[model samples]
Target: MKILIIEDEIALQQSIAESLEKENFLVETAADYHSAVEKVFVYQYDCILLDIMLPKGSGLDILEELKKVGKAENVIIISAKDSLDDKLKGLELGADDYLTKPFHLAELNARVKAVLRRKNQQGKNTIELRNTVLDLNERQFFVNDKNIPLNRKEFDILNYFLLNKKRLVTKTGLAEHVWGDNSDQADNLDFVYYQIKNLRKKLQEAQAEIEIESTYGIGYKLIEK
Candidate 1:
């Protein structure tokens, strides 16, 4: 999953980013209100961790802007304010959940998973595509009731495609999502080609009939047969 973290505290922001990255999530961060607004306007995210207090503006304003524009991005408010009015207001403004400051990273992680489940996965940990089932918690794939082995990158690629099924994902988008922003400076996208090829082979070998169609000059799309 891809996440946008809007927090002003540099230390806490980096910590949250690192922890989410370790869970195999594509994480992007914004340190202040304007940057956060720009990112939300430009890119899509599965979820957003928004801080109630920001350097230039309040996170509530950001949430209000999103709602004004009809953006359905799932938002979880992370704030130091524990007032009932604050919580109610956030929820009223379409915040999916709220977590106070000084909470455990593990707890935050669990809440993230919960919100993702409720928002994207239909409150389930497993995602069922046409011929495959993906166990998000275990990072495993099953086909025809049998487990299929996939390397980390292969799994990441497959999971990303599955999550974005039927969407035309550009090569640049895939590279940035899977390999991070540093991929933009690479000399070649051979790594992406290799990973997609490997993932295709693994699924085919597992008797899964899914296919990824290359868009020639564009990117790829997972097509269900």
Candidate 2:
């Protein structure tokens, strides 16, 4: 999954980004409101960690903008303020959950997983599509009740494809979603093709019901076989 951390505190923001990245999530960060706004308008994320107090812009305003654009990214407000009004306002503005500062990182991680489960897997621990079942908690994949071994990148790629099944996924988007911001430094996306090829082989060997189709000059799409 991809996550954006909109926080003005550089240390806290980096910590959160590192934590999420360790959990195999692609993480991007914005230190101020303008950068956050720019990121939201330019890219898509599975979830957003929004800090209400920002430099030069309020997180509430960002939330309002998200609502206006109809971006359905699940947001969790992390603010130092513990007031009910703040919580209520954030919730009313479409935040999935709220976490106060001085909270444990473990708690934050759990909440993030819970929100993702609710948003992507309908509050279930597993994601099922066709004959494939992904155990979100365990990070395991099963096809026809048999476990399919996949490397980390392969799993990430497959999970991304499942999350956006049938949608046209660009090579750049796929790269960024898995490799994070570092993908931008690459001169070519030929590595993406290699990953896809390996993943396809695994799926074919397992007789999986889904397939990843190339869109000529565009990217790839996940479809049922």
Candidate 3:
């Protein structure tokens, strides 16, 4: 999953990003309000970790922007303020959960997963399409109740495809989703092709009901076989 961390505190921001990355989450950061607004408008994320106080603007306004466009789904507000009004107001504006500052990274991670489950996965840990099941918690894939082993990148790529089934997924988007910002430094995305090839072979060998169709010069689309 991808997460946006909107925080002005440099140390805390880096800490949060590192912790989330260890959990295999593609994380992006916005140190100030302007940057945060830009990312929120430009990309889609599984969840957003929002800080109430920003450098130039209140984070509440960001939430308002999200709600206005109906892209507001999984948002967990993290702030230093513990006022009841802030908590109530944030929830009223559609935040999934609120965490006060001085929180453990483990707790934040747990909250992010919970929100992704409740909002994106419909309160379930697994996402099912036809006979294929991807377990979000266990990080496992199953076909016809048989577990299919997958490497880390393979699992991330497959998870990205399943999340965007049948949609036009560009190679750039796939790279960013699986490898985060570091993918931009790669000399080429030839590695992506090889990984998908391996994943496809495994699925075919297992007689999976889904196929990842190529879009020629574009990327791929996961469809029913």
Candidate 4:
């Protein structure tokens, strides 16, 4: 899964990013309000860890902006403030959950998993569709009950496809989601094509019931056979 950490505390932000990355999640961060706004506007994330206190603005404003723009990325508010009004306000602004700071990292990880399960994975650790299984916790993929070895990029591509199944996923969208914002600087989408090709081959070899169909001149779609 992809996560954005919007925090002003550099140490806390980096620590959270490292921990999430260790769990095989793609993580990006912003230390202030403006950068956070820019990221949310440009890229997509499975979830966001929003800190209420920031350098330029309140995280409440960020949540409000997300609501205004109709962006539905699951948000979990992380703040040092423990006031009931702050918590209620954050929830009212559409944050999926709230995590009080000075908490355990393990607890935070569990909360993130819970939110992702509720918001993105249909409240399950494994995403099962069309004879394929993606085990989010294990970072493993299976087809017909057989394990399929996949490189990191291939797994990320497959995960993205499963999330958007049947919807047209533009190459640019895929790149930004899986490869992060740096993909915006790439000269061509050949890398995305290559990853998809490899992922398709693996799935076919395993006799998986899903196919990544090219949209031609546009993007690709995941279709169940």
Per-residue CA lDDT of model 1 for 1-225, tens digit only, reads 999999989999999999999989999999998999899999899999999889889889999888888774589888873454776688899997777676667557756775676575556788787778988889998998799988887887887777667767767667755674457579989899999998888888888868888999878988887
RMSD of 3: 13.0
Considering summed lDDT, which 10 consecutive residues are worst modelled in model 3?
A: 175-184
- The count of residue-pair clashes in candidate 1 stands at 0
The sequence of per-residue lDDT tens digits that candidate 4 reaches over residues 76-161 is 88887345577678888888777666655655665677567668546677888979999878889999899999999898788767
211: Cα error in model 2, Å:
0.4
Weakest ten-residue segment in model 4 by summed lDDT:
102-111
TM-score of each: 0.54, 0.54, 0.54, 0.54
lDDT score of residue 120 within candidate 1: 58
- Model 4: clashing residue pairs? none
Q: What is the C-alpha lDDT profile of model 2 across 80-113, one tens digit per residue? A: 7445577678788789877777555655675677
TM-score, cand. 1: 0.54
Ordered by lDDT, highest first, the candidates read 3, 2, 4, 1
Clashing residue pairs found in predicted model 3: none
Which one wins on lDDT?
3
lDDT of 3 by residue, 70-154 (tens): 8777998888644557766878989877776666675577567656756755567788989899998999999999999999999
Per-candidate count of clashing residue pairs (backbone under 3 Å) = 0, 0, 0, 0
